[model samples]
Target: MTNHAAGSIPDAANTLVSENGYYGAYGGSFIPEILVPAFAEISRHFEEIRHDGDFWQRYCALLANYSGRPTPLTYADRLTAHFDRAKIYIKREDLNHTGAHKLNNALGQALLAKRMGKTRIIAETGAGQHGVATATVAAKLGLSATIYMGREDMERQYANVFWMKRLGAEVVGVDYGSQTLKDAINETLRDWVSSFETTHYVLGTASGAHPFPAIVAFFQSIIGVETKDQILQAAGRLPDRVYACVGGGSNALGVFQAFFPHDEVGLVGVEAGGQGRDSSNHAARIAYGEGKPGVAQGYRTMFLQNSDGQMKDTYSIAAGLDYVGVSPILADLSEKGRVRFAAATDAEVVEALQLVMKTEGLIPALESTHAFAGAFQDIAESSKSDIFIINMSGRGDKDIFNIAEGLQDEEWKGFIKRKNSQFEDQSR
Candidate 1:
């Protein structure tokens, strides 16, 4: 690994927000008027504390002492050898505390809530990683935490739900709508409407209305900042192309922000193409479907909607990416050709996950496997000398149960059933 002075890096403040939350024609606060003051408070304090040295000092301290920072940039030697000529590097965000990069923003938001004197934290989660991260930070900071998750998600990601409850968080399951992330978001917003006084909503992703997309991106920028520095030091040059999987675009935007101004570097985001782009089961918002401008879940962005203007159902093997809409910033970037968008089918993602585990001895989250699939395809068509870096957004542990079922591993399922039965009997 190459070593260099970390203090010499350029400040990324200017990259945080170039506009008042609009990343082109998209992104604006379309929330109810009753919630206007809550958004304003978040905007005012975020603007002030973002530049405060003491605030950063505390944030950085937490990152280093608590959640591991400067996560390794691992050169996938074995995996790279599988390709004809391209070099591959994985930004191992899976190694972060709580086994994902979600903690970075979770800690920052929780701290901001503390500064604002909010005693309660509420959030909407899909894969449950964000909820667990939020709950972890809330427990640490002595904040009451409540997480809204879809009933289906709670079952699929029961491991995360269990941890969130163990961490003293109250997990509520929403059975309405698609009974997924979208429904959970609606429930969280409804809760915020009445609890805005004593509670702060820790939105899980970089989507949502004004202030949220920008704020989440600002906090998650740590991933990109370190990636830039680490890659520059290791290779003495930036990678030719950077890849990240876009769920609500938190990890994608996090790693893309630092490279946004670097026109020479290409940024590609992988969306979940569940069955195929042509099938209605996919979540490839920008890649297919009606790419019209609309408003949903408090933000004006491109959504999967019917002709009647109602949001359509979305699906993905990766629960985290199963959403009807994407981040407005991502929508604008994809439209303007600043960032390229690609998609991988669920089958392709599973194959990629298995390939990475076998070749690199590292298991990637199913969500991140989409990026692997896209990057591999891109590398296959590109020049041999090209370098590609993919953001490994999370670990695969949380996905073990779902993956086992997907792979039809009867042995594993039987073992799980036996263990679950024992737990139930003990509880009685």
Candidate 2:
């Protein structure tokens, strides 16, 4: 976690994980033998389609026409004024359809599934945005969809579950283990072991096994492509730093791709600090030594685990960032020092969420608020001329319930109670 000497780490350009799958010994396919052929098939198809101009043409068209491409890079005037230091700009991924950058990968993967002759889609989600996005795309493509979500996450993010079901996808609640993202992932992979013939498991983030990390990063790189052009256009130069919240690392990798070639631009990834770094409940993998190198969820990476190598519990105010392990790419980057990592406590995240909403009039998702919290920490030391770009990964609409419960908003709870009572009375 300390600063490393120049030349000690691999060049960022060369460190990008490619088709071979291993990111400096961090990623590999460790799945069941039955799924090996299916993974190989996916890898081969991805390799071909990634190079096919016509395939990309179709994917890009959907991004532009359906999911809304070129999300804004808005300069935060009030936040700049408040900080009185570096300039602040937000890469407004929250403005995209489905209210997050998840849609970009969803549409791309769903298209790939169709081309591969897949008739059904199976996906796992934590905060449910990925489920909603997958469901939305499945509906558009006329494919049957099933979303696996942890019982706890589904409860906190029921709005997304509602939308997923409304989109005609089947939602299954997994109550095993922690009943959260990790459990959802476990169930989804279990389902994939048997259903890979006709179903494409749209692995939501740049985690999991070999082809998935590569596939997800490939689809997500569009965010960086847009951010690079938008930031250069808006700021007249590359930003001094790029900040993004890191859960499964798709969003951070999405924004980090364009900046990788610009070695001068610093990259920072913020992990969810559930209670505080000092407490045992948080998920600050790098900053707090909460995670160690371990294999879980089909890949080898940093995971919250015990000395016996059993997965440990993790907590985060935002369900999306509550996972036990991170993307192998992120783990490699953290080790190489190509990207520095930070932690935002649950308190800091809430405060940043309120502050951003008040200052910039933007209601960012709770997961994205962690980035704001991390970037805000640098404002005091940053030069006035310095530029910073924060990835607002999603909107806050689906997070209303989670935020209300976290804040213990009695009035909101009372309203929910009354609504439930009314519905119960009518039903009786």
Candidate 3:
């Protein structure tokens, strides 16, 4: 462990094995025979190329020229003042070219695909940010892109559907169990099994079979590196806490990796409380589930599934946060109490969405609203007066359709009442 002026913990770079993976009993490749060779080839090349100076320089050039890297860190002055002079700053990943933090990892993976001479790219998405990012990069790199999206999500997030089409990606609608992220993933896994020789599966977040979670985390850690330097330069010190939302836990891991060295700096992860945990709807896997190791879409992690290997139905207004299984690294961290996991109800997320828009003039992705809900509440209760940094993971444009759909629903009142009761039950 390295010590800084701020309190310190283990360095992330040192936490990994020589093979580039982690999660003590949680993460590894559990794929079928056909895809195993492809994964092994990709993993071997990735370890070599990651250290190539020329490769990274080209990657940096693309990030600067195309995706606009070194995203700004903005101070939320109005909101900060409201919380008793505690400085609240946001890492503005929402302003990235594709309008979400997903672009950072997509660009990195796409570059790797180009080097591997892969001619086609396949990906799975929930709220569609990853699909849009993949589609954007595939169009730029002149590669064919296929995105598998759940049938339910395809209908709900139609604007993003149009965005993918405009980018020239073929969007395959998955109509399996529940027609959601898990089903979309199942479809993508099937595609990988059939076409691993000619295609690359660009996993969206930092959670998947062996090399993927580690590789994605390495790429996204740029967020934390830049944020650390930027915050120190701006505030003349490190933040007292950092907050981010977890889907498959990529963005959260990205931002958290930087501050992990600073043990005094709290790392908080927020999950979608959805309707509520008690309502059999929320996606707070760490907080409410019996959480056992299981494989879903090829990665072993804590799953909200049954003994017979059937997944439980999960609900969240933010589709990105509705995965039935979380990254094993996160599950391990939570189990060890190295990090704190909290849930934000849909009502709390809505309130947070409204708060940032009204005070900071920023409408964040609905998934990110969960982080704001937790951070704001933590600030309200903490006695320590220090700076806080939160990852503004994505912009809210895709959620306008969700908000509009909610407006037209006749069950809105009843839905809210049931959600409120669920929240009350969990809180009590």
lDDT per residue for candidate 3 within 306-375, as digits (tens), equals 7798888888989999888887777777776777988898888887888888888998999988899989
Candidate RMSDs in order: 2.2, 5.3, 7.9
Which tens-of-lDDT digit does each residue in 313-339 have in candidate 2?
A: 889999999988998998988898889
User: What residue pairs are clashing in model 3?
Assistant: 7-263
Off by over 4 Å in 3: 1-14, 17-20, 405-428
Q: Which 10 residues in a row give candidate 1 its minimum summed lDDT?
A: 1-10
Q: How many residue pairs clash in each candidate?
A: 0, 0, 1
The list of candidate 2 runs beyond 4 A from truth reads 1-15
Candidate 3 differs from the real structure by a C-alpha RMSD in angstroms, to one decimal, of: 7.9
Off by over 4 Å in 1: 1-20, 420-428
Q: For model 3, what is the C-alpha lDDT against the true structure?
A: 0.82
Report the lDDT tens digits of candidate 1 across residue range 98-164.
Answer: 9888998899999999999999999999999999999999998999999999999988899999999
